[model samples]
Target: MHSRHMSIVIPDTTADAVYAFAADPDNLPQWAAGLASGVRRVGDTLVVDSPMGEVTVRFEPTNRYGILDHDVTLPDGTVVANPLRVLAHPEGAEVIFTVRQRDMTDEQFEADCAAVERDLAALAAAVTV
Candidate 1:
């Protein structure tokens, strides 16, 4: 399995604020900045349309933290697992978003990671200030 980790620190945000920002996908464009449009939910999953492509992110949240299982569906009908995590840090927050690229090109994987990193930065911005 292929994996990548990405994280960002929020300067002055509370845990609740950080969690709220990261948990809501609808608030993505407002904060995430990269997503110019569409995001919807099915059960616990969030489907987003990004400049890179369409990716459906699924999550399971407990009392302590949440785990995101993503699936990026290509225009040609290919799909892959996108694993990630959103943890509430004592001082800020940390997110690790990974994509498996068994059949994907190197560029696609890098773009996806970049998208996630941008999203994480925006999330931190929204929560902190």
Candidate 2:
């Protein structure tokens, strides 16, 4: 199990307003830059579509937080589980995306962190400006 933490600050933005986008799966590509789409329900799993490949993603939201679980299958038939959390921050929001990979290395985890960071920035920009 590998864990990484990421945060994005949205100036003059409320948590709920930001969450409306974060909570919606259809809006993922808007921020993630990957043309990703998902269902917003607990059991509704979203799939990110790309020419390289496709990934099945799911998100679970609580009264105070949200969790996104993604399973990406490589063209070679290898699959990975990436679970992320979105929590309320004092000033903005926090997203903790975790990955449990048996065949990957720490460097891969770092790359995943970078991906999440991009998403965070997108999330902030979507609501602030």
The candidate maximizing TM-score is: 2
Q: Which 10 consecutive positions of candidate 1 have the poorest summed lDDT?
A: 57-66
Which residues of candidate 2, in runs, are more than 4 Å off? 34-43, 61-64, 68-79, 99-102
Root-mean-square deviation per candidate: 3.3, 3.8
Error of 2 at 52 (Å): 4.2
Model 2 TM-score? 0.68
lDDT (C-alpha) at residue 47 in model 2:
55
Candidate 1 — what's its lDDT? 0.64
lDDT of 2 by residue, 5-84 (tens): 56666655666677666766667767875445442333565556654466555455444555555565555556666675
Q: lDDT per model, in order? A: 0.64, 0.62
Error of 2 at 128 (Å): 1.5
Per-residue lDDT of 9 in model 1: 62
